[model samples]
Target: MTTLIETFAALSDPTRLDVIERLMAEGELPAGALVENTQMSAPAMSRHLKVLRHAGLVEQRVAGTSRLYSVRPEALKAIADWTMDHRTFWEAGMARLDAHLALEEGEGE
Candidate 1:
């Protein structure tokens, strides 16, 4: 779907990624809340949100005069699973880094 593709594109932007991270940490929030939390202009946050909504990564609902946005875990989970399928490369590197850190820590022990 176009939304799926758009979601990938939205997430690829650094600022948008930061937005996603914040929402993941804080849970659902109104659009203005996100703007305040991120210190982004309302218009900038609105544009970012538009991309996310188009990508189906977030759900929006009307709350009186405001629109509240929430992360759609299903979409994120799908992306996570898809990325995990090619996880070996990254995981292997992480395992090596873990071992390296452990060795350095043990040396200092």
Candidate 2:
């Protein structure tokens, strides 16, 4: 439960989400690559990575002088699927709000 909260909280930040998205699509990346992709400083990127690490949203592997970060998709997918299952969640709310609802919503607006 705590891990789930931490994982969602970790991705709450835009920079961390950017890091996660880039790494997921591109595979493993070093700090420099993440920094370049995020346009954040080295220290800032490091801090974001730290938050992600603590949340179990990401894992790091050391390769020579650099550390590479990668997405743990199974854990992420578990969180996503769990959140998807809860009807009260914002994701579900949005999902429930599709085009059909929008037509009816126009009468109230």
The models' CA-based lDDT, in order, is 0.83, 0.84
Tell me the alpha-carbon RMSD of every candidate.
3.8, 3.7
Give the poorly placed runs of model 1, Cα more than 4 Å off.
Answer: 2-5, 88-109
Number of colliding residue pairs in each model: 0, 0
Give the Å shift of residue 25 in candidate 2.
Answer: 0.6
lDDT of 2 at 100: 54
Candidate 2 segments exceeding 4 Å error: 87-109
Q: How do all models score by TM-score?
A: 0.71, 0.75
Model 2, 53: alpha-carbon shift in Å? Answer: 0.7
Q: Can you write out model 1's per-residue Cα lDDT over 1-109, one digit (the tens) per residue?
A: 5444666888999877877887798887888888876656899989998888888788899989999888888888878887798799899999999999999999995
